[model samples]
Target: MKAIFDDRQWHHDPKHFMANGKVLPSPEQPERITRLRHGAEAAGCDFIAPKDAGLGPIAALHSPEYVTFLKNIYTRWQRIEGAGEEVIPNIHPANRSDNYPKSAVGQAGFHQADTACPIGKGTWEAAYWSAQSAVTGADLLADGARAGYALCRPPGHHAYGDLAGGFCFLNNAGIAAERLRASGLRAAILDVDVHHGNGTQGIFYDRDDVLTVSIHADPARFYPFFWGHGNERGAGRGIGYNLNLPLARGTGDDAYLKVLDTALERVAAFGADVVVVALGLDAYVGDPFKGLAITTPGFGRIGAAIAGLGLPTLFVQEGGYLCDELGENLTAALTGFEGA
Candidate 1:
């Protein structure tokens, strides 16, 4: 596996995200990339830096209105006197009817889906390039690499076509699948992030051309609590293309793998030619934020199972925070894939 990364990008910075009603230290820190970097190196894997491919591919999966909103909003908000900080919505949409503010300040309320993502002046540039990392990984798969990893921060699964949430500006996995779809190959996204891939699911929910599957902690008792239920299969032509396997809190390795294997079987029956794994390591037993008890050694089996698909794969990094065993966990997964 070739790992793609950018050293300068991190969503955990105080300026990058706001959580718990305050500017907490970044959980999506630079060390997340550093850990993966070290893991790939220790596993004797290839590592690559991303090459810019512009926004055409991203525009395929997201709304033009939303993209324009993200790219230009920070600059517009900066012009506001005393609005020098990163833009965050104090009043959410639920606070009012759907008809909210239309200005950049008000638009911020409309575009931002949650408080976790706060955009500073340089946010668009970072997110764009971070997504470019995923695009590059997809391009690598299309160009005939068996599998590659895109360690992008400002994780993208929580980001929908036009709204930002969970420290994500662009849906990296969705964007990568779009790139593959443009190349005439049907793609499937398997999001194993602890949190539901609300954004990726929304992007592909109405289309039959791409399949999106997610396995996460049950939304009834987790973040992004409104979505990720089993009943949200799909709509219109996409009726059965979307699948959600919401596990209970404290779901462990054996049970998690059993559920995931069932999900993987459905994905195989879908006849997808390529696969995108939204690989988030936050489900680890040692993860500070969640109760999921996925052990360190279990990641090897997880990676092996994804590899078992035998399709071209692009592993897009999602939500794994700073932790002592982060690198070790990833190493186990990649090593398992290699050996498998």
Candidate 2:
């Protein structure tokens, strides 16, 4: 398998990932890139540097105004008087904030839903290339590769069209799915992140061409509380195309796989020509998030299960913090996929 990656994503180096009033350095520390690269290399996967595919495909997945907002957020921060640091939000609108502020501070509040995803000098490039990696992976899958991995950082599952939350700027899976659809490969995104892929679900919620399915922690107690419930199916032509399977906190391997099996069944029924996996190893037992207790061995089972479908696959790396088993788990998952 080939692995597409960018070194710049590691430059995001966030200060913290907070939970329940506790502040701690992100568990998937900046060192994550090293571990991911190590895993791919050890797996004997060919690696390649990413090339810009331009903004046309990304624009198909994102709103142009929102894309402009993210690209310029850092530069805009420099122009504001009090914006002495990377952008973070202290204020947010109840619904949608209009009469948007000219200040980068106001834009920060307007765009970022959570404290995660602060903009730094490297963020825009990191975000851009991350999405580019996934989009390229999709292109590779379209070309009939059995499977490929995009080891993306500054994960994209949590980003919305107009907002950046949960350490994501662009929705990589969403962008890739758009590219696959544009290339006339009937595509669907199966997001297996521990946290709900709210941004991806939202982006395709109104279109029939892209079906989004997510299996993650239930929103009632998860990081993103606004969406991810079962009730919010698709709207318009997209109705009945979206699916959310929210496992409860403390869910285990068997439980997780059961949900995945259900998701795969739907994907097959949908007749998707290519499957994009929003793979997140954070569900491993030792993950700092600690909502789910899947083991390192379990990831292999998950990967194999998806591979069993035999569809051309694009694996978009989402969230897997720095755990001791980073390499072991990734290697095992790839092995399982091969076995399948």
Candidate 3:
């Protein structure tokens, strides 16, 4: 299998992450690429630097304003006297429907969904290349590869059309699905991340062409507390097109696999021509989040089961943090898919 990545993705080294009323180092670090790359290579994936797909593909799903904000926000924030090194939002509108603001502080709050996605000097470049990597993976599928992997760092599933959250900026999996859809294929995104793919769902919520499904920890008490409820199905023409399987906290492998079966069945019913797996290894038992208890070997089984769908698959990296088994789990997933 071919894996898509760009060295520039290592540039977005975030420094601040607020949790439990205290600030700490961000988990979305550059070391992630090193481990993931080693894992993909172990799985026999040949690495290829992604082409500069430019803003056209990214702009397909993200708003132009949001894209511009991500690109220039860091520098703009620097101009503010006594500004923190990173651009973190301190205020947000009561509702997003409120008028857009001109102040840098208000814009930061407008574009950043939460403090987790801090905009550093290198964020825009890294995010741009991470998205291009996903686009390149989709291109590989379009050109007839059976499967591809995109090692997207500072992962995406949590971003929205105009807001960044949970360490995500550009929704890589959503962008990949859009790329496939534009190529005249029916794309279904199966997000297996422990955190619900709120952004991906939001991006496709009003459209019916692409199907979105996520199996994640129930949001009632999870990091993304506002969305990911089972009843928050798609709206408009997309009604019945989105599926959310929110699992209980501490859900283990066997139960998780059962939920996955349901997710795949929905994808099958959607009559999808291709599947973009929003692969988040954070669901592993050893991951720091501890949302799900999927063992390292469970990842292999998960990969094989997704392969059972028998569709061209593109695995876009999501939310796996640092752990001894991080690289091993990724290797297991890719190899299991290939072996299946």
Candidate 4:
């Protein structure tokens, strides 16, 4: 499979994030690309730098104002007298429903959902390229490639249309799905990230063109503690189109595969023309999160089952922290899909 990536993605290396009420070194770092590159090479995948498709593809899913905020937030934050090294939101409006803040600080809180996504000097550029990679993959699929992989760093499923969170900024998977929809194909995004793909879910929450489904650790007691639940079916025309299958913490492969079977069944029933796998290896047993226990071999089985859907597929990288097995785990999934 063709793996789309750009070296610019490494520039947004964040140093820290807020966790456990303290600032700690960020797990989402530049080194992640090196391991992923090794794995892609081991799988015999060809690497291609993304051709710039510009803001049009991204604007298809994100709001114009929000996009502007992401591009200019860092510069705006620099003017603050005592701002930290990176721009992290400290204040959020009590009523997000009726008020929009004009201060850079207020805008930061408004646009960034949490401390997990910190905007630094190179964040915008890297995020821009990461999104372009996803768009390029969609272009490849639209032009007739049966499958492709977008090795997007600064992973995006956690980003909403107007909010950045969980190390995600631009909602790359959602942008790819929008590209598919513009081509008149019904598309579906199946997010297998350890955390719920709240951003992707919100983007298509009221639309019928793209079906969004996620299987992750239940949010009631997990990272994204607000959105993922069994009853969050889509609203209006989108009702019955969105599905969330939250599993218990410490669940393993057999249980994961079973839930996946049900997720795929929903995709088939939806009659989607293409599928975007929001691929995240964070579910691996060795990952730092430890929310799930999917082994290296288990990823192969997951990939094989997704391949069985028999539809055009785009694999978009989400989250997988540093580990000795990072490359091997990625290689296993691609190899599994190919063999299947």
Among the numbered candidates, top TM-score falls to 3
Model 1: residue 66 alpha-carbon error in angstroms: 1.7
Global CA lDDT computed for model 3: 0.94
Taking the tens digit of each residue's C-alpha lDDT, what string does model 4 give over 141-174? 9998989999999899999888899999999999
The candidate, 2 or 4, that scores higher on lDDT is 4
The Cα error of candidate 1 at residue 148, in Å, is 0.5
* Backbone clashes in model 1, listed as residue pairs: 12-26
Top lDDT hit: 3
Model 4: colliding residue pairs:
none
Write the number of the candidate with greater TM-score, choosing between 2 and 3: 3
Tens-digit per-residue lDDT, 1-340, candidate 3: 9999888888998999988999999988899899999999999999999998789999998889998898888889999999999999999999989989999999999989999999999999999999999999999999999999999987999999999999999999999999999999999999999999999999999899999999999999997999899998899999999999999999998999999999999999999999999999999988999999999889999999999999999999998999999999999999989999
Residue 294 in candidate 3 has what lDDT? Answer: 95
Alpha-carbon TM-score of each model against the true structure: 0.94, 0.95, 0.99, 0.98
What are the clash counts of all predictions, listed in order?
Answer: 1, 2, 0, 0
User: lDDT score of model 2?
Assistant: 0.84
C-alpha lDDT score of every prediction, in listed order: 0.84, 0.84, 0.94, 0.92
On the 0 to 100 scale, the lDDT of residue 317 in model 1 is 85
Off by over 4 Å in 3: none
Cα displacement (angstroms), candidate 1, residue 30, comes to: 2.6
Q: lDDT tens digits, residues 98-152, model 1?
A: 7846778788888888667888766887788789999999999989889888878
Per-residue lDDT for 62 in model 4?
Answer: 87
